[model samples]
Target chain A: MQLLRSYQLLVTWQALRKKAYLPLMMAVQTLFSLGIVLGYPLLFPTLDRTTIYLIATGAPAISMITVGLVALPQTVGEQKTEGSLAYMRSLPVPRLSYLVADLTVWLGIVIPGVVLGVLVGAWRFGLDLQVSPLVVPAMLMVALTATCVGYALASTLPYMLTVIITQAIVVFVFMFSPLTFLPSKLPAWLETIHSILPIQAMGEVTRGTIAPNEFGLPPGAFLVLAVWCVLGFGVTYAAMTRRG
Target chain B: MLLQIEELTKVYRTGTRANDRISLAVGEGEVFGLLGHNGAGKTTLVNQVVGLLRPTSGTIRIDGRDMIADPGLARRLCSFQAQAQVPIDGLTPRQAIDLLGQLRGSSKLEVRRRRERLVDALDLGEWLDIDAARLSGGVKRLVAFAMAAVSPGRVVMLDEPTNDVDPVRRRLLWRQVRTLADHGAAVLLVTHNVIEAERSVDRLAILDQGRVIAEGTSAELKGRLGAALRLELVLSSDSADAPISPFPGSSVSVGNRLMVGIPMDGAGQAVTWAESLQRAGAIEEFTLGPATLEDVYVALVGGVETGPAELEEARSATAA
Candidate 1:
């Protein structure tokens, strides 16, 4: 009963706290997603059907991933620097309730962007999307893993370092990861690194679900994402629950 | 005692001792003040009580339950206003207060009533709907106080509650603090403001260098200065550096101001000496009043260096 009440309170508290900037945040996310979908094609004179499918499906994945990895961390870092995080910790609410509430809010913020990205991608490319039944669960798992990791980073590191690390992550995700492209195009060493990291798994699961006919589902991707999701929650829980 | 602390000690990993073997208790209907200068361990002690920080070695009891063993219970029993103002950039005073009250498990109607009372009491009506980011620091502080006081538990711990507040609102805030205690809550107030604490707290402990140097009712502490009167002189520019201890008392000098302790029997002589100094253009003005808790504080905090020999010499000189 206490857990349920705390969860309800935290959701309302977090939603109100974000009410002012949520619209602006969503607009930015939409723009970023639209930019990838609309602008990336301008870089190429002619795109093949396979290329179109990859870019169209990859836009939504990037949008969801960015919300969790980039936007969530920045917000948490600001809260940490402002001492609001410590203030919240001092409350009598259950720690897990706070974490779940935060994840729920960030998920809400990203959903519109993810949907818009997928819609705009299909319309722009005039491509066929074989959306699988697993799409919703796959998107949720990717977002949960990324956001929990971001939360853990912000909770454990100093604010300035978290900011810097998040920025570095943005560059790595956009430039190095195979989210928007084929893994075979990258060097073997880079692919090997991506195999161990969660970013590739996030993109692979997302791509498999959104374009199942074009890409096969890899059993290892789900296992990798689940491992990261649990690890992130564990680290974040430890950080929040530790005394002094 | 509603809130009891025994030998509470907190030492940071950096090896700095923030609190040292401090022990104190507050009864259910008491407004107890923890008075000290900056870095004197007052806020540190409050943080431990509220479970934001852990004490290295100590026992905290709220209503006979060991709080250190169960910090969740500590948090449930103690509602705290942190030293830093809560970040509510996008929130209004009303929303912030109401949300916190609900978060603390108050009913919606109860939250509304408490919010209205706090807004009226703090004179926050004009700024109730304004964005807190646009409000002044004092208003934000008032909002933070309201948030904590809205659904106060068995104990309410406030740290530097009056720091940036205006004089009028400070009095109102004090009234609310007392009201909290009157409703059967133990109030633990931490601050560096001596005069306000003396006026507001039923009992207080003065901390220095992480240790409690003195503790008692305001009158009891002031009585330590035993019939000593405080003679304050506004020295003229020309006499700013003059060593003007014509009477028997310990004196502390700060730029253009001098405070001297005089025996009550020497009140007339002290006044006459002040008049003489004024006539000679050594001082611009002077006032003589009974020593206050501030005097006892300064003496004990080593501001006047009241050593045994100096105290004996002052006594003999006053007698002669």
Candidate 2:
């Protein structure tokens, strides 16, 4: 077996056993996102359920990605400083495995995010969340891809810098993506920006399927995300392989 | 080979050399002590052995498996008790042991069997139910040691095994190390406390600035000194803290261990020191053992230059 997968699994196990708070935070975030979606029905009762579904799906998936990119790094950074990283390295387990394990656990953390997005969209829009047999397979793809990206980011720079940059970029994109008239109707540069951001891909794909036609997602969004998965994985792989 | 490290060199990216061209071997049933002062590359070498830090160039073979090339196989063969505290604040010591055992692929029955015995031997009974973060630094070090012993592996590498431990427990820790070697696990001990090494180590290596300057058995190393002993004495009371002629010699307290030097040249003086201690009821034990590994260390590493007057000072302080 490749050590990378072993590392990912080990990191996942460590988080489950030692850092249980990570998952609890994920649960809370997902619940809050769901609350936002559910509350929309009462506040904007005039709008049709389909439109409400679109907003709910895009909003929470974006939030989950943002939390994962930002919060995860600070925790990992603290561990590195306290010498836990050195302690684990002293074990027989490969250093790469430790990195992988951390990323894998982060992927598991986002499950609550997905559930919130799905449930909110379903209830508000009256759409079919009746567990598409496809959900599992799609989610599995999204998971491995997200981990490849997250772990890659986690290892590339020092933890604090990664967390800061990740939060700034994630929040900026989330708040501004909807306002970028290009994603719905404008310029080449802005469209290019929308084309590659993982949140945008998530919003487009999720919205395209659940409420239908809100983000004006073209087939290009899937292709862009696929490129990201491949490139994110390559970058992470290259970065970790280069480290001592 | 229990352990065969060949041409192990670690040069950090910043051009600092931590470990430079080191080679070593340890056979089963032997306790090998690696001595070095702080920042002397002792921890660096040990860390590489356990796969904590990758070496710039070299091969580490434990039980005939290359640790760098096949780390998982290496991990399976070795148990590392590091100097740093293990983070298992979420679990009790018992649960921590169980979790580590499971991680090592031990059966539940196997874990239970080993834990029951080690819990008492390491004096972990008092802290079994407590969270690791709540453990005192000494207790946490013991906990780390216990975890190393909790699972059975072919090679055991312990960094500073007796640091912060009481003398009574230090004795127990050395006995446990000897027992581990006796049970056929090659033991690697990294320590700066030469006095402890005097009584315990089977063979030793003195490391200086990432280099192994001297390596040999304690007796072989000490034999180079011809005839001299590192002696230390302790008085029974507070008034005894005042320096006086116990045996007309000198001694110093190195943490809990009293340090003194005895010269064979003054046969009458040595006798007087022993007799005075026995007479005053100040001496708990007046032993004339052969020169220890510490003497060998001072002789070879620091160069032997202790004087008769210093010895007298030590004797009086310990006797007083």
Candidate 3:
């Protein structure tokens, strides 16, 4: 009964709190995803089919990552500054329920953009995408892991620091990470970092699921995502439940 | 007692003691006030009771259940209105109140019923559907109060609940607070408003520098002042400091205001002296009234005094 009440409270409160901005956020995500899919090709004179597939599948992953890492942290930081986070903490609900509810809301927000980005990517590139059945679970896992990591960051750090870190993560994901290109092309040390970090794993899983014939599923990718997901949740739980 | 706090102490890592061995109790159906100035640990004590801050030492028990061992139970049993305003930017007052009521485990219908009652009681009918972000600060404060009162648990803790409320609605809000206590919940009101606390609380504890200096009902606390009357002087200018007392009593001066406690028999003398000071252009106005909790507060808190040079200069200027 306690669990049910906690879930109810968190889900409803979170959803309502973001109600005015959800549509705008979804539109922004969709526009951002579309920009990546259609605009990236302008940089390269001629793209190979594999490169096109990578960019196509990469757009959705980046969208999920942006929402999770960039948007979620900013929202949570605002809540912190506004004292709403403390108000929520004072509620009788279970602490973990807050994380679940936030994840659920963010996932709902990211799905429209992901689906549209995938369709638009396939249409623009004229590719017969061999979308695997595991795509749903792959995308959900990527979204969840990104959001949990962001939630943990927002919960633990001061609001201004959280905002700064989130902006830095955006730059890292866009410029340094292997989301839009092959990991082998990067330097060895950075490649190793991507191998351990969840960003590359997120891209790999989504790209592999979307174009099964084009790329083989790395055995370690799912494992990496699972580990990061757990770690993120553990940190977030500790931060939320700790009395200070 | 529904809420019992014994020697509750909270020391931050900066080595600042926000609460120093504070002990108090509030029984069911009572409005207990923790009255203190800013940084006097009133909000700190409330935060600990709601389990938002863990106390460094001592114990807090809600209905004899140990809160230190299980802070979750502390949160579950107490509904708190924090000193900071609750952010409800997108939500309307009705939505915020209803959601909070449901969050506290009330059924939908029950929550709706209680929300309606609070809306009427707090005169929040017009602001019910307006976005809270657009509401006036006082209206938003009323919304926050309704949110807490809608599903007040075994204990309700309001930290400076009347901060931004207007005079007319503040009366309404106080009535609602009384109604909450009358419903058998222990209401712990934390505020520095001496006048409101005196009238609203069944019992109150005056805290200064993290210590409870006095605790009692309004009449009981005021009884300590005997038959003294308070002589208030509003100085003519900010630079004008309080003159040395002509009578045998204590006085507290803050800014351009001065409050001196004089015996009841000295009221006529106090008025004559105040008139003289007014004619000397040292004071803009003066009032003499029965000693209030404010006088007791000044006597206990020993408020800051202007420098001797400043007082002497103002006195010499008045004489000249």
Chain B TM-score, one value per candidate, order as shown: 0.90, 0.76, 0.88
Listed in order, the DockQ scores are 0.31, 0.20, 0.43
Note the clash tally of each candidate.
0, 22, 0
Looking only at chain A, give the TM-score of model 3 against the true structure.
Answer: 0.96
Candidates 1 and 2 compared: the better one by TM-score is 1
Question: Candidate 2: which stretches are off by over 4 Å?
Answer: A1-19, A22-24, A27-54, A86-104, A117-133, A178-182, A185-188, A210-220, A230-243, B163-170, B223-227, B230-262, B267-320
Model 1 TM: 0.93
Instruction: Write model 3 residue lDDT over B141-182, tens digit each, in one string.
Output: 889999899999999999889988999999999999999999
Each model's TM-score, in the order given? Answer: 0.93, 0.75, 0.93
| Candidate 3 residue lDDT tens string, A135-176 | 999889998999889888888787778888889998998878
Locate the minimum summed-lDDT window of 10 residues in model 1 chain B. Answer: B311-320
Interface RMSD of 1: 13.6
What is the Å distance of residue A39 in model 1 from its true position? 3.6
For model 1, the stretches where C-alpha displacement exceeds 4 angstroms are A42-45, B246-248, B302-320
Error of 1 at A59 (Å): 2.2
